[model samples]
Target: MHIENADLNLLKALDVLLEERHVSRAAARFHLSQSAMSRTLTRLRETFGDELLVRTTRGYELTPRARAIRQELEFILPRLRAMVRGGDFDPATSTDAIRVNCTDYAISILGPGLLPHVFERAPNLSLTIEPLSPRTYDEIEHGRVDLALSPVQPPAGLRWQPLFEEDYVGVVAADHPLTADRLTLDEIREFPRVSVVVLPQEQMVIDRRLAELGVAQRSGLRVPYFEAAFTALPGTRLIALVPRRLVEARRADHSVRLVEAPTELAAPFPYGMVWHPRLNSDPAHVWVRSKVGEVAAGLRPGTP
Candidate 1:
């Protein structure tokens, strides 16, 4: 049987390639081989009469035409998905994998409570938590990540839902000599510090807070995850200002202690969930996002 426009699938491939900007990674999204993806890109260029993607010294970039079409594709694709699915999600039966983009810190704070809530309703569904990366925004825009949680707001054309606010406190080794419920600027500056960087362009919010207080952070150690910062304090004078909740969660295992930082330091930064406009109305996406919001609400201070 001859299928009319079997090539329609190539349009889907084109959307992925345009967002990914890398043929290899785009291929991985569709589980296609590199050579096949390259051929697909060649076909897309032929169909659109544009280069579509061009290699640069740094990496591949979409051509102007490709970029222009993406804005329209983002609008059409989700509608097309909803049309095809044609029904509300049944969590008990659906086994779809929900890809979540977040830091380990969020998993530490929300996962313990969130998982039970999600599994109770959707035992067959699975959640895959991915670490934050520079490409997280792109991943969401392109449909790779179903949801994202971060302190930084994403670009426009995405939904941002404020989940909870967080504040920072200084953490030190449980056996450290300085025995204060709170530390002054002079005391904090006494030791070399460690910092957490989520991605290349992203620095932790506390970095700005520290600079505001004129506290010189001797960043002898820099790590990617929040928990790594505590490892510096075991037998050393090193201390860091991490989320108060994070410190409380890990204190028992790491033998770390949390104390109030200088009075100049403010309360917690606002962290939130973000998603692409394309996924905003998808039933399954909405259901999972609702569950996440519920979990975040219960985890806030003074909630029973």
Candidate 2:
């Protein structure tokens, strides 16, 4: 098991390769030439005595050995980094780009409120906010996502803090007949629906609820964010069920009005921040996370 001139970069390379599961992508991450990366992969295989990434018809798949390696790395590396780097975090001087994986709904809720702080404190700070896609837990543990704001509950092994409970409401044109009063489930079911397309984690719950209610979004305007739903609802027969927070966020848009969904049809879920335990002691993460909690707490849940 002894090798000459063992370089730490090899382990780093293996880690990235297992994560990306694509040679070119991993090579780009390490800024290595394609042929150089291939040589590094060869060395990794020789050292580990396992084909860490085996190519499949669609793409590369990790062996169980690779998964074990990843788990080990996930346990050790970030905590080591945190120990070395942890300190008082001055948002004013922080230029590190904080990547938050979330839906547009989260962006609407967090970005504006956080930006003033981001600007006033960390003027050079850049925020990259994007949709929550598949393998969210893996992404968070691997440092691919610095934070997540999701309505969908976190999977086991991920740590989460519930920010607030949110209630769903029906929104339509200001003059839409459905706004005459709180909507009955029958009225909601009969309306042409504009569904909110969400991440994979949230998709199942949504689909299950819709199936149980026997309702379909017939308006044919399916969108990933509630903002799009707001845009679609005005001056049309389309009805959208979205978080009351969304209406509060975009109330100035003045394109739609919100009414309560029938009590039987609406369900409440907590939207919160989730992160990996590896980041537990990261000072910068702790500070911003607290700010997020403060914002979420102030946003008491109810009709906008």
Candidate 3:
């Protein structure tokens, strides 16, 4: 398709109609009368050589061609808006939604504090916290999310920036016996342990670290999320090996005690921010990444 002779106004009209999926709503979005919007839709059909949107019982539905082009519009419309607005990224004024994928641990440790800072800086900005799915690398590569924060290394073709290094700590109830003494690898291995089973990539790194230290323990329970692991610790005699930052965050609310693990078992678990190269130049994404890095820096060893 030769975009050189295309009507740019029609592109904007199509974008609004596709999003609203109704003539009246699309007219309201563009501040046009319903008749004007209908005319715009007709022009769009002629330009695209397709009905694009077909009426449905519930609402308007996109044809397969329209569905295929929806993502392209999502990507292109933002850039077009930026260009028309003189490419200014005024955080205080610009309203943008950023999608981020991360584990429950990252959200517990970093999300609470980071969100407020982001809102303060960019009040109009919205956030979508997506689950860190098994196919996270593919999600990042295909632009399903703006950024990903995880302990795993990024796959090829993606860029990774190290945010912070977390270390494993032994967590138990405040009155647990080992809270008074430094936790030894042998002692940790002897007791029932609550382990948070992450994705395969993270599991590989943790397993490698445990093997290096010869640390083997009987798993009392395996949970999918960190909050579950933390919740399981208050009543049981089970000890949980979790990130120190997470333990510190929950210390005030829960009567949990954090004991440093033996140096050999206290491997540095580095969490990083990964994004596709295509988004490397996106201003909003860069701003969000920088803010996340800043929050991570402040959460250093004992500050969380």
Candidate 4:
């Protein structure tokens, strides 16, 4: 390889070839005829001085050298693609709409600050807030959604930027007796509870912690939003384990008092934003992510 003689376009073809490991399938992926893809594969073999794909008992398999190239390509291709497509984005003049998928909990804490901050800087950009649903992962992977916020770790193949850590606090009616002192895990377990199950296994962290101590959230009310848990707490003995920030924000609005959760149960968990790697170096996306990071930084995770 000399740069001047090499056809840079074949890099993408080679990537698809190594990934698909079958000439016809790789050709289909690149929208080229089978014969054309075969020629491209020949060129790749000649350029690299190796048989990139070898016939196996089952089907085509990547040669060791091809495997090494595939590994490097995965890291290189996305950046190259982003660089080619990320042409001189100006946030103030750009009309890009960024869709964020998150729970109402995220909206309650992050929306108030994030919304205005983004608008102030990127005046022409549109921000769309959508609720996190079962289809969220698929939406983000396919670029239907630009960003997602969650405390749970993102599945592999996505990028995570930790925003803040959230600790759980027990909330009850202002006059509830549990507020008088630090409640034990057993005491907390004895009371009826309002559980926020925003997504499947959203409670796993708290649940796992409690389970280690031989306790569980007492069965009472189950709601889909964190706000619902707050509203459900007043005028009742329902003890809810909610984010400390939620209590700080709405305690005045509701007749609720925050009580110290057991030291063992008050472990703080990380909350953050996740996005696809294709947008890693995209200018407009980078601007939007930076603003989100700024807003998250200002939150300054605090103790109850």
Candidate 5:
């Protein structure tokens, strides 16, 4: 029979059928009905021009041709599988680079910890983080970017894995006059604000929620990064709502303190890794994403 016209799936069925020496047992292995497996066995006999399985007084037995084919498949199948499936991945010696797109605030929170964690395991692999933009998902789809950190829900045909939920906390200078354990919405509006606007009309969820409650802050300054928002708050009554993890991670760099956010504004938002489904099973991708999961888990205890 011509190889091009043959159904290669029968080869696998032949292998199992030869080993089992019973049609029903072989059918069970593949979860196929006995009638369906019998049809497959008939097709196999026609393809090879041999009765691959013959009935004896006691049970079924393999003919000479079937035994010879079985021996050949034992040698060929493993190599064929190896050729189809590539070699295993080893991160310690890998030089592959993974590109990630994320906001500066996300970098401020995850970068310091993620870098060290990745380096400790991979050492040779490189990580490139580009600023998140409207084209971020397009870049990922086209194979330019490997992952993205986002709170925005992804569109269809993409995959997301939640890393952690981050709370919004009020940040002010350590010596600001509005020194209260928790400030009311009216009190927060009284102070000038340092707003972080990474994209056009990109308001944080906290701000949107506040506006829904008829509260708005007076912006004394607008910056592009979360770190800048903290830096602009010192020696002034300017206040900002930023991620609590970001404030705690970079607190030593600036003289800023965290104030408890009001219950209305305390709703936490999820930050997750978004990636194209194409790389969902790639070994190297799977390994690095696990490392990322480890780093994110360390940020907040008991994260799954």
Candidate 6:
């Protein structure tokens, strides 16, 4: 691990040879002669006490030890290159891929606008938005996702940054009677309710607030996604309680009206940007999180 004694150039040459699997091709890639690459491979084998590559019927094969070290090399090589080329990241030229995990509501409210801004700034940077699964903490811990946007707080040992808070609102068809009057829990409960199957914590919060005020309602339907609930409200008497940001983002095109829920039943839900502590000091991760914060700021209350 000591940089002073390590053969950094040999490591690079070995990485290319491992990937190319042919000495001639590896030499071609590094613009070196085949003999030079062969010697480099010999140094690598002696340095590591392993025949990193062996001649095989299929050109070359990596030893088990080499295969084990491949992942480490892949991770470290990039950082090495980045360290050599010191400069601010230009998204337009960077081809980095960022992966984010988020709920359907976040995708609906923020994703549509966020992607374009990112692309405009960093055309070569790609994004992969994964569905926010139930075991969010596990996914983040295991590196299955880079960032997660959720209303729930991140589990212990993870870093959770509060992005913004959203208030609950009732969404009904544009012509629903509740749109004509101030929405109260009594009036909202009078109609069939469309419920989204969310986390147990969310259910407890809703039930606790409603029970405190003695409000009761019958569930008309249950859906897994907020988009489904939003689409289903066009002609039915079903009213859905969803985040105000989600409703506001779609009010222009969707035939839905956003009504303030009863204060007694309304509660502020805090949405956060969460990531593993392992990536706390990573520059790329910091950039991505800052972009997420910028998006959250634009959507915060009174931003309009």
User: For residues 1-304, could you state the per-residue lDDT of candidate 3 as single tens digits?
Assistant: 5677569878878877887789999999899999999999898887788899999898899988887677667656665666665646889986666778887888887877798889988998868887787887887776657788988888788999998887777788777766554677787778898877777445645556776777775769888788988888876788887777777777576577777766676557678999888877677877888899988888758432
| lDDT tens digits by residue: candidate 5, 160-206 | 99999887788888888887877678877788877777655666677
Q: Write the per-residue lDDT of candidate 2 for residues 197-284, one digit (tens) a residue.
A: 6753346454557667876545457777777778787788787778788777666767688787777657777788999886677776
Tens digit per residue, CA lDDT, model 6, 203-277: 534555676787775868877788888888988888888877777777575588777777765558678888988
User: 47-117 in candidate 4: lDDT tens per residue?
Assistant: 98899999999999999899988866754654565466567876667656577889888888887997777
Q: Locate the minimum summed-lDDT window of 10 residues in model 5.
A: 74-83
TM-score of 2: 0.69
- Model 2 lDDT vs. the true structure? 0.75
Q: Quantify how close model 3 is to the true structure by its C-alpha RMSD in Å.
A: 3.4
Best-first order by TM-score: 3, 1, 2, 4, 6, 5
lDDT of each: 0.80, 0.75, 0.78, 0.81, 0.80, 0.75
lDDT of 6: 0.75
Flag regions of model 6 displaced more than 4 Å.
Answer: 1-88, 177-180, 198-208, 211-217, 300-304
Residue 237 C-alpha lDDT in model 1? 75
Q: What is the lDDT of residue 287 in candidate 2?
A: 72
Displacement of residue 134 (Cα, Å) in model 5 is 2.2
TM-score of 4: 0.69
TM-score of each: 0.72, 0.69, 0.80, 0.69, 0.67, 0.68
Clashing pairs in 1: 166-268, 167-268
Candidates in order: C-alpha RMSD to true structure: 7.0, 6.3, 3.4, 10.2, 18.4, 6.3
Winning model by lDDT: 4
At residue 268, candidate 5 shows an lDDT of 80
> Which portions of model 3 miss their true places by more than 4 Å?
11-13, 49-51, 83-87, 173-192, 200-204, 211-220
In candidate 5, position 194 carries an lDDT of 76
